[model samples]
Target: MSKRHISLKDLANELKVSISTVSRALKNHPDISPELTLKIQKLAADWNYTPNPLAMGLLRQQTKMIGVIVPDIVTHFYASIISGIEEVAKQHGYYIVIASSNESLQKEIESVENLLKSRVEGFIVCLSQETNKYDHFEKLNSNEIPLVFFDRICESLDVPSVVVDGVEATKKITRHFYENGCKRIAYISGPEHLNISKNRKVGYLEGLKECGLKFDPQFLVTCNLSTKDATRATRQLLTNKILPDAIFGLNDTIAFAAMKEIKNQGLKIPDDIALVGFTDEFHSTVVEPSLTSVTHPTFKMGQEAANLFFKCIRNGKGFSEKIELKADLIIRESTLK
Candidate 1:
């Protein structure tokens, strides 16, 4: 007869260590010394051992895994969010399976399907740029699986969501610029399909109206958050007869590009024109004068999404609970005026 597959417990006994210790060593838990972990890992490999992903999935009907899909993994905001989710998952004795949408609806759908096929317990995602259709989300909902939308969420899906108050956050930042002796403030926002972008655009106009500043269509520029688009948008602003006194961006990446171009054009930050950005994130503080942006609670948002997912997973009828987190404005060198 064929010998039975060796288990972690069997390895632990052979190594004269407790099962818990072996498990921790295998996972490379911080408490385990690196030398000991290396020894344990060698033993497991010598045994031709394999981590039973399918058996684990069967145990939880869940793969003991959660899927996290984001618009782009390169952004600091999303990276922070994933870190938080990983922490929360670890606390719950679960692991994360992350994927990047790269702003493609097809990719998002394919990723979701793959995770589902693997029996991931739940999903947390930020929709892609081309995800205007609600059918994919509807399909997720219909599967009797848990789906939590975070950050760039859909407006149509009545599912649980985590996002900052875009309209109010933009209003606060734009109003601050208006009060600081800056009129003709330009708005550099993201793709128009994004709900957050639309909300912030509306708030920018509202801020101008609130400060008795007339809204100018010429001051509004939408870009794809790329270097080329950002450069072209900045050039468009320079070509205009009416120069903006300040500019507010939808996110830090676009803001950084625009800031670079503005400086190259002999413009000074908070001097020639003040600037504000959303997502007070990485490189914001490292930049020359630093960037003043709406500090989004990405980590907390991720935790909330995980918590909501667990609730749904445990409670059959409570999956529809919606959550909205508010954005905070972080004062820095860029908007000190």
Candidate 2:
């Protein structure tokens, strides 16, 4: 038979005292006699005793857990980010509970509730594409829960955040294409409501603005940018009264999709439409006319976010702190003149 736990009753019985007295003694209550305290300590040390963390948590009001959330688990970027978050979590002796929002507000809310039900100490979140309503998160904010937004944060939320200047990164690449003698440029942006996507659009406008080119909404296309979606968008772009001399994809995935479809449409890359994208992906090198893109330090972002999370836990109140990491431009064959 398994050995039974050494309970408060057992300790009290051994020391000829009540369970309440033994409890107070274990808690370092000053009223307990020093002689009795020493005796209880010695017995506890000898018995290989373990205090129940759950019971301790009941007194302190915490479960000592942290939660991290992202939009997609399959994306290499988020996976790298999560790896960084986990690395920092390990250093602080905190366990992380991760969930995927899958770009849906409903799923995001469900995940939040699930983590809260499990008594997570705090939240590190990436907003979902469908989340125009911030009420759910606002409720947590009002209750004074520690919430940090990473990557996809709502500017209005006023919460601690870690992010990059997506607008500036996109502007740099877009200007590079414009300077290379590309007259008509096409933009393939992500889902419309996403903050990252909006930032990229601002960059696109700024790029055009600096080039003294008129901003035509027709030049921009909003789509999921899958290969099939790119094929259709490519056809639509080509069927226009004017064809683009270059294309700016929000990320490498969109760039790859457009690259293949544009080539199939009988246009030589660079010679026809030079391509530039955001987020330097691994596949950029493997693809023909290797994509030039805005480089994001996903790993560092995650590591830093996790590091800050520990500070929040330690501080308890988790004062609002925002950390912005730098992004670099990776020039490659796709955007070379």
The best candidate in terms of TM-score: 1
lDDT of 2 at 83: 91
How many clashes in each structure? 1, 0
Candidate 2 displacement at residue 159 in angstroms: 0.4
lDDT of 1 by residue, 201-307 (tens): 98898888888998889999988777678778877886789888888788887788888888999988888878887898789989988998899888898888888
Give the number of the best model, judged by lDDT: 1
* Model 2 per-residue lDDT at 308: 71
TM-score of 2: 0.77
Runs of candidate 1 exceeding 4 Å displacement: 1-60
lDDT of each: 0.81, 0.78
